[model samples]
Target: MEHDESLRFEVLGPLRATLGQSELDLGFPQQRALLALLLVRAGRPVPAGEIVAALWPEGAPASAMNIVRRYVGSLRRLLEPGLPPRAPGRRLSRGADGYRLETAEDEVDLLRFRGLTRRAKREAATGRPEPALRHFVEALDQWRGPVAAGIPSPARDHAVFAEIERELVRTTVMAADAALLCGTPEHVLPHLGRAARLDPLNESLHARNVLALAACGRQAEALAAYESVRRLLVRELGVAPGAELTAAHTRVLRQEVRSAPRKRDLARPAQLPPEPKQFTGRQAELDSLRTAADSSAVLLTGMPGIGKTTLAVRWAHEAAERYPDGQLHMNLRGFDPLNAPLTAEAALRFLLPVLGVPGHRLPSGPDALAGLYRTLLSGRRMLLLLDDAFDTEQVRALLPASPGCLTLITSRRGLSGLVAAGARPLPLDLPSTADALAVLARHIGRERPAADPAAAQEIVAHCGRLPLALAVVAARAASHPGLPLAAVAAELRRSQGSLDALGDVRTAFAASYRHLPDDAARLLRLLSVGCGPDLTADAAAALADLSVRAARRLLDELADAHLVDESAPGRYTAHALLRVFAAELDRRP
Candidate 1:
């Protein structure tokens, strides 16, 4: 076999001709189109009639053969410039039957992609799922953008490329499924989510999502997936879910009950770390949360680690008295970095057993699960703590219909939807100076106070009276028992070196800011640059040079994001640390 690897052609994005490392610039559009047609046939000779049909689908021109010869001559001269002086024919030779463009298989990305996909399928059929997943991922990586992204071809060829794109999507879902079956939902969830979005009507993609969600322990969300699929099928196709999907949904809802209790629940309970010693201030905030819990849903929105979860858990423990049935807790993994978000179906599965429902009896869809959950808690009073929720959709599906059931949702983003849905929102602020000092004194003994009251006050003010910051500062002081309070205050004054003062509190602020959308982030940066303790919507609008209405909407979005505190209606202010962070971000390129 004569091997010619130097010749390469790319037809995916755009038609290109190259010889070895140097690209051959085929100047004429007709010449480039002719070369693409030749490459598609690979080593096989294509009859002149087929070539004419491909170029002119409506009908061939009178001078079609002459035009083809002219384009072929132009392509050969452009692409085969380095070829040794030939004796009889060009590198792109015209046979009596038609024409042939020969190149090695390795030179084409499309052929390589197809080869890898085929190998993956073979590996999967042999039960080597792990290897199949790796191959499929490799094949996908070969695609830089959509298939034939920039290429303009005949309608027939375009149809062929579209079919290839669809196949690629299917292959991706299969790979994701293998990843899920291999016990790696975190790795597969992003792929599945992307696939789901790409082909929203694909039932297989939705089914794969359920498997991935269940593997991630988000069983409620898994069940919710089934409901979404069912609804889509009914709405779009006027059909119910297939038997396989219904069976899978049933299994997920019952998995928890069928499984035995985990060791932690049965064995001696593992002692939790002692509660943070200096949880001061927020008495009013706590009372408001309790009151909201008594009525509709209570959403506690604040900067991350701002003790939102801490306060929620504490209140749940305190209010455990009212909830005779029991208190239920779930960390929804709302802000997880590597996994798909927890869905309502998965959350329902976690909750059903707690409500004493048997595995087989639990509903298969979010609506059904939610209805059953409400029915179980209809008469009995219960407290639910849903921590780290991402969005309203996630929380809304899991909400209990019964007024007797009280829910406390802690999220970095303010649950505006919850508020609009008649759930009360209790926003948390940084602790007061006195509260911060008390927290510090509680954590690090009061001996230092008599020595330097001024220093203690200074430390509280410098820490911005944020409880998380004060706790960290207090912990640092407690760890160094002999350190003078004045020295600690001096360290805090040097903000750059005061890592010990902020600790995880800084992380909380960062988390909340990270969740803001691009527009909201821009608005925040402008707000941080402008003067005043707080700005009205009009002032904020002027700073960004946006319309008053536009700026008002942005400000509301920021407020809903919890990055900007709504001190008064239509007025907003950033927390001290958040202001500093936003200023730093704005100054950067």
Candidate 2:
């Protein structure tokens, strides 16, 4: 009955509340995150543990529950001023489980978004395209950015938020479909573009974009759109366009006619693995890869389990557009525990067929195969990801001659020989604290880490920012959502650099060790008990009781193999996880 709106809330982007025309400050980050969580639940009672967990992602304080109580009271006072201390709130209510924000569907932007989306779908299903398109656009307008954008990064990245984002993508995709059906393709272009950017590899979304462009009479743009996603799928996912996307391409080319001569595409293999899900961190390295996208080859070298292959694949997918001919991948299996390093001959044998060479018609021997391989790629622009190469010689036979091609290689070894021949060496080191947390967030779950930030930091610090270690910790924590990160950190601390807590990262280190020369292997074990953190070449001589020359030579060998890092001019350091691994080997005798 009131002309002035009494209350309104927004959770489509940053959490917000408004009384009449004025916006209310949501107080600090914790308070804002709290409100956002409740709004996401949408009037359903959130449990106390869930609230406490989400509010203090790093870990709740000793007085965390009390702080939550106080924050709620303050929020209530802010929402309904001039109320008595013990009075119940009309909008914010406490229930048996925890708390909930009571608001009508019209009073919250997200609720309105959901309502409009349902109505839109219903409208379209019932033969009402015009109104359906309107509902879709109206629903999409609710989002300003990522949901709960201004809150804690973990909360902003929570699974619930990710689901909301997925819903947005679905809606955007549907909106584009609706626009074309109703003959208003131009109207949905902006939303379609936004959704496409959010999920560049989504074939369905890109398919709709292509069709919509064609529907609007921009055939050239539509064809380019098709090629873009086609290349994206080929290079990033290692698969050609699925039926839906290919059908869309077919529709665009024919322009509502029965048929046209199908365009011929050269047989190009899309051999890349699926893009890694929730790949976190490594921005600096990703940027470096971007800058070096024009280069013929880039090497990602680091200790075992440092995520070199993951980074290579992640970048390959991102850089796929540049190489429309195709993408090819080979796991050299350089450090596989159960198998020998894939021979260059075997690698060539595997790769030739993937490049469209017939297996029976393939030439025998590495030289002939390598030659044919180079000739096949000579004129084409392509992307090659040679994963887990053992040595320089192992990959040299596999390098292509085309300047138009880019090769990405991942190995634990530095592959100095390849570097001398012009491979841009990108040594993937430990992730930054922020990126480490992001990695944890990506693997485990964002909400838990956000709840106990200190515990999250402890886990990162204890894991030494190694993506592999973080992933292990994340896997454990993720399996048990209610397990406090502090408990995880405490468990890692108790392991005392033992592999018992870090999962199969120890197994990964063992592969590199198994392939090490005897002298270098012994030196690695002795140094774990030697003055740790690092050792000079001369100091290594006294510790191992070998000549300084022998220790120095073995040290360099170890350094080249990446069992130990060359921390300075002549000094070397072992990673904590590696140190533990070495100690385990030392104790075994």
> Which candidate ranks first by lDDT, i.e. highest?
2
Runs in model 1 lying further than 4 Å from the true structure: 1-277, 289-293, 335-341, 356-363, 496-503
10, model 2: CA deviation in Å? 88
lDDT of 1 by residue, 1-589 (tens): 7644386667655666567667778765555666666666667797887777776777778998889877777666666664554422445787888998766667776677778889988866544455676788777665555454433456336345566667767877777655653344565676566667667777767776776677578888888888988998999999988876776676677673122222123222111223434555678887776666657588887765467877877777667677665667778877654455689889889777765555664645676566445544544566778888989999987776556678888887876788898778787777667777777888887878657899999888777776677778888888998999999988888774224357576566656566677877888877667579999888987898888898889888877767777898878887776777677677769
TM-score of each: 0.52, 0.55
- Candidate 1, position 450, lDDT: 59
The 0-to-1 C-alpha lDDT of every candidate, in the order given, reads 0.70, 0.83
* Superposed model 2: Cα runs more than 4 Å off: 1-266
Q: Which one wins on TM-score?
A: 2
TM-score of 2: 0.55
